[model samples]
Target: MENKEVIEPEILKQVAKILKVPVQAIKNFSEEAAVNIISNTFSDESVAYTEYYKYTINPFEKWVDAMDKNEQLFKELLKSEREKIELPEKLLNEKKGNK
Candidate 1:
């Protein structure tokens, strides 16, 4: 893509805060990677919780930590997935696109 659509900086920073991870971890990722992480995350709101068990160490606080983590993870997962999918050349070549 001429331009890759990445997550907003402000939103990514907010997510980083909840995950206790550095903003650069997510911010520095390529747009395609970012898209995958977020898409994979929110693909199924209900299933999102199940995925967390695989990522973290202790029980997350309900409504607060858990929710925040899920949201942040969703964004990251979408980005990761996007990176895997690889934007098609046609889309990437769009005159207005940026990648």
Candidate 2:
């Protein structure tokens, strides 16, 4: 595979944004180090672009998928916790009402 000689400024900015790090971090990276950083950062488009030095698939897809999974897991956990706390209160309230 062909390696990129230098990463574009715009791409570096995007990577920094995704990683929540300063653009200087990316700029200061050696080419190989930058490539490794992009790959591990999991910014799909950035990773793919760094790999092939071109756009491939939709980069946002991976981010969206990860966010969706997290949201679903959070909802499930909230529901479980709510049930644990509510069940006892529900029983107590019902018993009081019936007495």
Candidate 3:
């Protein structure tokens, strides 16, 4: 029987789910080499991209860092929106009277 091959994105997503790590952490070596590279990276965590002569990055770390930076921006946006909402005193009184 011929052996079946696993593809890159599928292996990456599955490993991320199983390891609770992140899809970005896994790099696809190639369409055909995906399974082998995944097994090596998971076991050693030191697999290098020979073409680049450096270790590949897990993308999730960069994503997390970016989100962290955006937190302050989001907080400022929410605060600005809240400050811009001006409730007239008459409207406030009317709402209280209705209640």
Candidates 1 and 3, the one with greater TM-score: 3
- For model 1, the stretches where C-alpha displacement exceeds 4 angstroms are 1-61, 87-99
Please give the CA lDDT of all the candidate structures.
0.74, 0.83, 0.72
RMSD of candidates 1 onward, in order: 29.3, 15.8, 14.8
Report how far residue 39 has shifted in candidate 1, in Å: 59
Q: Which prediction has the highest TM-score against the true structure?
A: 2
What is candidate 1's CA lDDT for residue 2? 26
Clashes of each: 29, 0, 2
Q: For model 2, what is the alpha-carbon lDDT of residue 43?
A: 66
Which residue segments of model 3 deviate by more than 4 Å?
1-56, 86-99
lDDT of 3 by residue, 23-93 (tens): 76544335558777777787674765467665578799989988988998899998987766655656788
- Among residues 3 or more apart in sequence or in different chains, the pairs in candidate 2 whose N, CA or C atoms overlap within 3 Å are none
**After best superposition, candidate 1 residue 8: deviation in angstroms?**
72
lDDT of 2 at 65: 93
lDDT for each residue of candidate 2 in 62-94, tens digit (9 for 90 to 100): 889999999999999999999999999999999
- In angstroms, the error of model 3 at 52 is 12
